[model samples]
Target: MSSSSVVAFTLGASFASIASAVVFFLRARRQVQKVRGSPDQVVEVQPPHPTWTAGQKQPNPFGHSRTVSFRSTDVVGGSCYPLVISAYIPRPIALVSTISKNGVVNMAPFSYSGAMSHDPPIIAFSVCRKPGGMKKDTLDNIEENGEMVIHIMSEWFVNAANLTCSNFPPEQDEMKTAGLTPIPSVSVLPPRCEESAVQMECKLHSKQDIKNAAGKVTATLILAEVVMWHIHEDVYDDNSGQGPTTVKHDNLHVISRLGGNTYGTTTYVYDLPRPDRPKTGRKV
Candidate 1:
């Protein structure tokens, strides 16, 4: 489309969305007024999103600049926190690291982990270092050994997952500190969680390093090949009878970090489906 057409289309969409929002607000005014308004007045408010700074590699608002990937300093400084919450506002995925009985160790939860390939079966998560600091144990164990098990934290395990974030010595296990059971896995030395409903045992594939403001290593992009998967049968779908895939909402509410001690969770959700619109441009 031409520039003028593009601008027109964008403005049209914006106005249409605003109109729809206003209609919904009017319809729900009665309900909203009950909790947040005077007996005769209605109130409407929109929650804030974590906005992006220039470092997140996001498209320039003016369409003139390049993308910028967010760094720890960006998150710490709140310049890119809106983007952190923005990225996680969708389905929140949990990152769990496990170590073996001998001496291996792992690190904390990062929401950026997910499956990339199904044929060879791969999983990925970006492990961030202290802005100018060394690699965390999660990446350390992956380099030393060749395997790890990333577990998903359902609502039940969200508290346990948060417990893993404490500042512990490299020798101390987050599992012990969190009071979770470390169950053995079939293909990896690192044990899986006895509590987690879903677990993927994987071997290292590749590492892509991210740079900090000082040109030092900021994060390591870790990709692993899924060798095995463990799931709790009871919570899974009857057809699959393997994992927690059947959980819709009540069983799988989530909590995630913001910048510091502050965090958020999806205690409630609402659906607003598309409305049917009357056709235009008729001869009549």
Candidate 2:
């Protein structure tokens, strides 16, 4: 072959080899992902430290590490969000349900939620504004109706619940589209998810807008007063009139939110009782 033809052939061969390598790399990566994301992995719940006592040291005590800190204001909100969520470990998820004045039902989950009081049964959740400072449908519905039902997410119905997180139009009913059954709540206008093990019917007590350093409202913190509760019989433990009521963990199958697209299950649990006050301590 001529010198020019030889050069052309060499270039074509190199391009073919490069393409083949890229295809192989992509296939291998997919296989690795499938293995890591497999749902068949057996989840055996065990005590974190079976043979531990009070004031016991960690197994790898000598492997202590130095602390690294960052100034909150120094980091931007976008970067700080992932860092805080990941470092905060597992947080409880609130699958809040609300209905607009036009009767459009909405459902979505939020990780920034928790119970604040027990006497009046107050709970709070914070909803961050979207890009361009736009309010989400959930926040708008709650502000319009002042009623919501917070449900505890469970393992069985988590897939369906996740589907409701999509940014659907306000005219769409997320509960129906996600294939979840909604039942009328006794004390609230918003419906409750039938699949949830624990549901709290609450009315908006008050709301506070959170501002950033730039004096712009970044989110809204809503405080809701639960007027009624709907607990599934399988997860409820009346204690037969003997002790305080509780929930069955195994039956409840409660799942919590982790950083990114991960979730945590309550497979392993350990109890630690509070120590009695020292007898030598001064009493008022």
Candidate 3:
């Protein structure tokens, strides 16, 4: 073959290879774009702002002019009971039932009560001394017997529960005065309120006496260990194949003590999903 013809054939083959390579590259790029969706549909996401900061001052929704501040001494020492109660807006009410040494059943409601532990099941309540620094009948009964039943008050029996708080004589039965039926408790000497949806049979664990500056006992804090739980069938959620059993808040209609003469009920409910952190060490 002639030298010029050989060069021409080699150059034509090189040009064809370059054209094929370019077409293959373009097709691969198109496939990558298809897997990632349309380029124009892509939206840029921005991180959310931090809700709180250590030293940064946030915008005051109520404004500085509307804010009020007071010293702790002023509320505690002075006759500022309202301010003190307002600090703890909502508190659970415990209808404590106890039997005196003389076999008199006593029932009284105390707002200073809540669950302190769950593993061993512990509940606490505080009873303030009555006029002339006299110990309350509920406190006296628990001291003698070391056994009591704590009842959670629902909307149906809130009024009756409050009636039990009256200053009745030790001989007078407040449970009967309130028109509440008392059912025998399983593991305690004190009877449980039949009207209550939930009842806890507890044994007194410990008692702490809170004294004033003059060393006079002002209140007694009782810690009790729950031995048995009696939940009404309607309020009890026995998981049984359905998810974990939880007290239906709506059905329970639980009541809470507010400041002063005010009381509140659980009527509104909302839920928010918990955010999960990213594996890349980014906060959710």
Best-performing candidate as measured by TM-score: 2
lDDT of 3 by residue, 246-267 (tens): 5655567778899988887654
Q: Model 1, 245-283: lDDT tens per residue? A: 343433433455554445555443344322353332111
Sort all candidates by lDDT, best to worst. 2, 3, 1
| Model 3 segments more than 4 A misplaced | 1-60, 65-80, 242-244, 273-284
lDDT of 2 by residue, 1-284 (tens): 99999999977766554555555556545544544554433233333444556774332222222243323446654437887788787889889999999999999998888889887889999998988899999999998989999999998899999899898999999999999999999888989999999999999999999988788888999999999989999889977866566777767778888899999876434344345755333222
Better of 2 and 3 by TM-score: 2
> Model 1 Cα RMSD, Å?
11.2
TM-score of each: 0.62, 0.75, 0.72
The number of residue pairs in model 3 that clash at the backbone is 0
Task: Using lDDT as the measure, name the better of candidate 2 and candidate 3.
Answer: 2
The CA root-mean-square deviation of candidate 3, after full C-alpha superposition on the true structure, stands at 20.7
